[model samples]
Target: MYNSNYYIPDLVEIQRQGFFNLLEKGIVEEISKRNPITCFEKQIEIFFYPEYYRLTKPFYSIQQAIFYKKSYVSKLYVPVQITDRKTKRVFLKWMLLAHFPLMTNRGHFLLNGSARVIINQLVRSPGIYFRENMHEIYSNKWSEKPSTSFRRFYADIICLKGTWLRIECDKDFSMWAKMKKGPKIPLLWFLLGMGLSEKYILNSVHKPMNLLESFTKEIEKNQRAKTFKELKYPYVSTSKKAWEQIQKLFKLKKTLRKSSSKNTFETKKSSIVSSSFTFFIQKRTEEKYNKNNETKSKKRIKNVQKGDPKQNSEKKIGSQLEAHELGRKWFSNKFMNPRTYDLGKQGRWSINKKLGLTIPIEQTTLTALDVLMATDSLMKIEDGFLEIDDIDHLKNKRVRTAGEALQEILSVGLIRLEKSIRLKLNGNTKQTFIQKNSFFNFHALISTRPMNGAFREFFGTHPLSQFMDQINPLAEITHKRRLSSLGPGGVSRDTATLAIRGIHPSHYGRICPIETPEGKNTGLVNSITTYAKISVQGFLESPFHKVYKGQVQKTLGVFFLAPDKEEHFQTATPDLRLTSLGFLPKNPIPVRIGKRFVRMRSHKLALMGVSPLQMISVATSFIPFLEHDDANRALMGSNMQRQAVPLIRPERPFIGTGLEARVVSDSGHAVLSKTSGYVIYSSGSKIYLYTF
Candidate 1:
């Protein structure tokens, strides 16, 4: 009837709910969408077995172990079944053994019989984050007020695979792409490369269709008379031409450095500088001269006001092209690889080289095109286009889903997917196989050894597995517990505790107040109350009073006995009758109801907001005598008693069992003997004693 290895009933429900939560999140749907033939059903079963232990010896047989070497081993295991949605067929049946990290009942695992708890962690959710900052530029003319510039916030798409694509815009409102050390490509071009539509990309970032239409109209109006063909189809232009267009779009005038003024003048006279370069230099020189004169005049005025002309004359003069002056340019040249320029210094370029890797853009495009063709999103293939090999394969094999194609690409290392398995596997093995790595597998802690036969028989096979057992019953049972702590990528204990203790408003009805452990883990380790339930939709719902005709009717209150009077009263209240008194305050005070008196604060009846009937149900459902003991003390008793050892001592025959009498004379002789009962009286020099 009682089995320690079997999962606790409440824990089983929680674990089942956790799996349903994943299903509700559409993870299975996503996987199925990617691999149409490989679908997953909603039905799942989990089985927990007892801890496994093994003793190995160098000798082949147990009889020969007298002089051979020996060792001990132990572990845990869980069995799982995954079924396909479309075919009503089982997809995978796995017996997860120890060495595989699975969630336990307490949100931890047992390793070598020692309990291990997981910690929660914080991770960036898959979404977009916007960032904006001020870009400050030095004043060109000190007297001319330095123009204030505002750089609009750009959108950064954090792909599900952890790739970051930054969308940068210039004064022309034309967007450019900047990945981690990747060149700046036109935004539209990059989207096309990813096999995504321009409209889809715009909608992903919340861009308005009206704004796009207006921008299109403006571009058409400005480029109507342009003879350049590339101007008409900028999105499809070559990278080099796109870069050149980006340059012309900004139209930043080249400036002559203050240090290069003499060189520029000589070059202008010798006709060494091109017309464009000459114009740029002259424009820069004029701007510099104006700035210097304005700064000097300001200094003179300030000096006159302070009566400190000598200090003004000593002001430091530095070259405009000094190392510090060109710091921004140098930094951008070395680190910022817009358009994939300066490949040698590009971070991704070097990384790719080191890994001997390259993205087969052509191959990716072909694959995308094939998928679109299969789905009829693109032009239909000609009737004779199908080759003999293609026709034969098409007849025998299921079409590869988009997910399958992507997975194949991933396997070839075309793109790196983010590591989702946070927990380490047994033997420190990094899980690379997606099939072996699952949402459930990542949380399961397994052991190899089978549980005791008696324990297995007592708990019996899981209901879902009973039919399978009828054909071939499992020889050994696997034990498992769903862990509560953070999985592989969880936060630390202190952080998790701090978060839980903060008591967010969302936890009001979802978490149980009475079922939390006492002391350090009080609120951190809590159990769901009986009335609380988690729905398949992933929301935790508890009972709430319903209003009839827009009015809440008065509810009767139950009487509860004080802790000291609990022994005298079998039930909290006599005959379980409702009292006229309503909810009472938290302060402890004596109250009379019917023919009994009790403390209102010390009992379940005093719980705020709960109806008397609900309170009675809660009290009855909880462990007996739990209300009488401190929560911390109860928790300590439950866990500590398991590790306690009983001691037995032998009694000594000489030890006294009952009352004894001893008499001593002035001469120093003493006698002791057992007495039934005695009385003594003193008369003159003689003492009288009687024994019965």
Candidate 2:
């Protein structure tokens, strides 16, 4: 490695890899699995099982697409096999799945002859994120005094595609849960619904006996007490009292169930019209009765209702229990079932990596152990044993490239296609299907419209999908490397807070601090640094050289470190002068480790940066004498560079930074000579060279 020198990495490799990944690993592997669509009742199964797919050499080339105003796309053919189990008959054929869009060499999709690029989105990663908020509540006392305030901690379990589960501690120190933004329910009740015994929960939260008592008292106050004024804080309750209350609640629930069972079930044929007509007749009959006798009849009706309080109470309790059971079932189906609440492979990996859990990555849905651990972490935060997360930090956010976005759209379209296949299978009976063997038209039954429509919807309406910026070669490449935080499943620009828009320490080398926009989207939209690359987990990383015991190891090469990993190592700046032998300066050097800026011995240094400009983007690095200019002016300078127009007689800058040559080479502006040659013939626009 060259000492104190930096080599430019592939700038547009991210975009290139993303598009190619979709074509290879994403679309073919995920969508071509065996038995993609199945209909058990009709004894039919449709397999996507890829026969072959073509990514390169599309049906319509880029030139043709531009001339004909068509999309440059490749055809996807899958071997579809339809099996009738009853008759043991099988129909096999190769069917067209879709006309998948193909990307150009410059990483752009040619849609309707216009080049488009999907801006990479910076989204909060899927995992349990903890937060604490303070709220003030009026005192129960009548005296005029300052209200008391309490800090409430919350843990949110975010999934890739399902309901969100938020657990928060109330002002009373009782834990409650809200699923899918539903009304708050006692954590104990939620656990109970999940089939956890009451005793187990009591044992779990009782480590801090006060939490258990508060939880039990809250349950009793909500269920038994009629007046809120009677409730008091700092509740002191024994285990016996808690057990007694729980038993009473169960008994009451049982009585309600028995009473509900006594009632007759409503017929499925009951219509809203019939119910309205009956109500109208009842009202008419009531009008015909004398006004004086109306009160007496109503009183008689009340007395008759009061005659069996148990019956009336049972009816009310039964409805409440039914609603409670319905909520339980809904949560189970939407949050617990693996089929409905898929977190995807990446989501599962993220959760496991974040929590350091040993659970298999294949278990994508939320589990009881995950809930318990998340809750425990909240308590740890309260006790100062754990750190609350900064949601805006790069560690908590990741890049969603075009590959992921396309895969999501494709998955949705495949689902729609599956539904259509199931409908067709259900419609045809075995007798009719056997009689009309010609009806087995795989092409007719399966339409590529769903996939095509999906692509159209994404390209037409998505905020991230934009017409390519072709003002200059720099602009075109910059457009592909752009990252935004506003889109579907991303933070709304209107509601984004200042904390989220401000620069953070983690962005030092990953995102360019000076290359953002100027107005509302100033920080929401940004560009990656020159040497920065995206990790497998989508985290941004910057290259650094390893320093071992006051010496820079040339053979070690450059190591890419994400923000989270970099925080653990002490890094020295490249400004420090090194000896001829590549040894560190013989003094306590000022180094940055984590958030602390301290002077440490050279032997303690872990990493040495390559250059000061490594933290800046290409546009910002191209400025001559950038250090002398103010940050605000430098930011404007960088912004204006992308808008620079090409000149008729192009000339290099008179006063320039050494980066001009590299930038020009990377921008695809100059065609470099590959071998020793001499120009034999030259024209006004072309140069012909003769080489040995």
Tens digits of per-residue lDDT for model 1, 1-692: 11122112232244334433432432332223222111122232222221221222222222222224321122223233433333344434345332222233222223323322221111222222334435545467564554766553444433223235555544434455567863454444333343444344443442322122323333454356353333433222212332343333223213333565645533332221122222222323433454679986566446644758573333222342332223333323332333122211122322233223463322211122221122121011111222211111111111111122222222222111111111222223323222433333423332232223222221133121121101100000001111122222223446565544443323333343343344555444343333344443223433332122222223422222221222232122211222344222345545333235566542434122122222211212223454577755654543342233423542322532111111011111222234544547766566555776
Once fitted onto the true fold, the runs of candidate 1 whose alpha carbons sit more than 4 angstroms away are 1-12, 16-189, 196-241, 250-487, 491-501, 512-531, 537-545, 551-692
Best by lDDT: 2
**Each candidate's TM vs. the true structure?**
0.29, 0.82
lDDT of 1 at 674: 44
Stretches of candidate 2 exceeding 4 Å from the true structure? 1-5, 32-34, 40-42, 50-56, 138-146, 205-244, 247-329, 353-356, 430-439, 661-692
lDDT of 2 at 444: 59
Q: Tell me the deviation in Å of residue 276 in model 2.
A: 36
Model 2 worst lDDT window (10 residues): 264-273
